[model samples]
Target: MLPVMAETLSQLVADSFEIAWDYLEATGELGNPDIAANHLLDTIEAMIRCGERRRLLLSNNAITAYQRFRAEQPLSLAS
Candidate 1:
């Protein structure tokens, strides 16, 4: 159970980071790519830390519910 929880959280964090990075690139608002890259890295780090804390606090049932909901969602072509 512990390992499963950890793995799920890790995957979620990675997915979030990818989504953020893709969004930033799509917007093309980053005038200074280097600065934006640094900011994105920092944001992802913080998101991971927050996700870890939330994972610890969430109940198994909550996690299961999230998994079910995610599974039910239609796949996006843009992804």
Candidate 2:
């Protein structure tokens, strides 16, 4: 599992907007098909990039934490 990462409130809002836009487009309710299609493509790309960055950040943070934990432990085991 990846380390916990916090997302800004704005990200949450943007996700909601994306979901709504997708729904509208799927239902044939979106006006200005050409413009909306372009915007949708852009938004999808941005969202994909954002997710990639988040995953990378979380993985880095987890590795850092694990290294710190190992460094702080003594070299002896007690049974």
Clashes of each: 0, 0
Q: What is the C-alpha lDDT of each candidate?
A: 0.45, 0.47
- Compared with the true structure, what per-residue lDDT tens digits does model 1 show for residues 1-79? 3544445655654555555545546655333455444554455456466544343223222333333443455544112
Candidate 1 residue-wise lDDT at 22: 56
Model 2 clash tally? Answer: 0
Q: Which numbered prediction scores highest in TM-score against the true structure?
A: 1
TM-scores of all models?
A: 0.39, 0.34
Off by over 4 Å in 1: 1-14, 51-79
Model 2 agreement with the true structure over 1-79: per-residue lDDT tens digits: 9988877646754554455455655755454545444445454446555664353343333333433443455534100
Q: Pick the candidate with the highest lDDT.
A: 2
